[model samples]
Target: MRHVYGWLLLTPAAILLIAFTHFPTLATVYESLFSKGSTIRPSRFTGFSNYESMMEDPVFWKVLTNNFWFAVGTIPLSVGLAIAMALLVNRTLPGRSLLRLAYFTPTILPMIAVANIWLFFYSPDIGLIDQILGSFGIAGHNWLGDPDTVLPAIILMTVWKEAGFFMIFYLAALQHFPEELEEAATLEGASRWYYFRRVVFPLLMPTTLFVLINAVLNSFKLVDHLFVLTKGGPNNASNLLLYYIYENAFSYFDTNYAATLTVVLLVILAVLALAQFFFLDRRIHYR
Candidate 1:
């Protein structure tokens, strides 16, 4: 009866998972296979039509392109900044704790809150960013309103917000590095860069991989702030895949098509996840 009791203990969580998460995803897949609108009662088994239609939809293609750039723009920038911040904060210095807190404060704040603050920063007249640019006799450009600048502006804020959180991951990795290995290199008269490249970096490889995967995932999932700031436009300029999916389901009531878009997103995420795992398996230093 011990085995039976163990299964019973697991039942509640299993039921909740199936009820909430698993069931909804499966339902989306089911819905994507059907005709959502263009019907009286909704749903007809027009297998693969929804997916095929996305290929031809110009708006869908545009949003898909936007999402690709969003991911490309955010992940590397965030990861690079995060690693740099981690290194800086790891040192013993005056005001180190305050610096850490300042960097990390954005990470804990709600994204909507950050969006509101950044909206002010991007304000055309007196906003901090434009105001600073104005000092040099440069015209104060509307950062978020311009198609060329919107994604990059959002990417900059996102990097600042995400970097400090990832820094904590690196800090933990830094703390656990075997002192002996570093000391051996130092005793051998190795330069600072040489020590970092040959000794410290190899040890932190696992943390780097973990943070990269998380940063990549965030690039796709964390587009909520864009809703408040961009609403996916100055002519859909900031339209990401998730925001586009939201537009379809709620704004346009194209539930069937939205379901299909969701499937595409899931496929994209799945591919990234697999790539992350493949790289991690090769890169992580087990010792």
Candidate 2:
């Protein structure tokens, strides 16, 4: 009777997982093996044809490279800033609450709205950055218009937007940490930096792992701001894989190719998850 009741309780969630996650993944894989249909032409099986085309597509390669750089640029910087912000705000300094709020406010705002605000900040000569540089006799340069600067500009905004949210996780970990360790370290005349490096950091490894995984996933998944900010402009300089998938599926009406892109994304995420479990989990110290 208990087993029966347990199965009954699990049924709805299992159904939902299968319906939404498993089914869609399988469907995407199925679709990626075929050719796209049109008004006059019908869909047909062309095994691995889409994948071959994806390999041949220069735009796909560009977007994939962009995503790699995007992840590389955003993850470490955002996570480091998050740790710094958490440490700063964790202390009972003057107006600490206000400082915390200020740090966290960007996380709560919609990315579209934030992107719009940043658009002005990146505008050529009229932007806030240019205006500030003008006072120092520094000539203003186009921030987003140039391919060299566009990806970096997007990365900077992403770090600013994501850092605070990661900070909350770090702060929670810090709060739950045992204060006795700090006291002992203080009695031993250990410097703050030494104590943090030796004692505090090891204990926070689990939280760091969690935040790192989240940052990696966000680096790939979060493309809402890109729509408003650049639309992958300046000759696809700022394009991301997810945004490219959107372009193919909706804008170009190429669902099969989009499915192929999605399959690649799924494989990347799966490999990342497996790596975290196998490699990263071993290094994390859990209490």
RMSD, every candidate, angstroms: 2.4, 2.3
Give lDDT per model, in order.
0.84, 0.92
Which candidate achieves the best lDDT against the true structure? 2
Model 1 whole-model lDDT (C-alpha atoms):
0.84
**Model 1 C-alpha lDDT per residue in residues 69-188, reported as the tens digit of each score:** 877888877777777788788878999999989988888999999999899999787899878888987889888999999989898888878888988888877877667876788799
After superposition, candidate 2 runs with Cα above 4 Å error: 1-4, 279-287
Model 1: residue 146 alpha-carbon error in angstroms = 0.9
Model 2, 186-207: lDDT tens per residue?
A: 9999999999899988887888
What is the lDDT for 277 in model 2? 84
Query: Which segments of model 1 are wrong by more than 4 Å?
Result: 38-41, 276-287
Task: Return the clash pairs for model 1, or none.
Answer: none
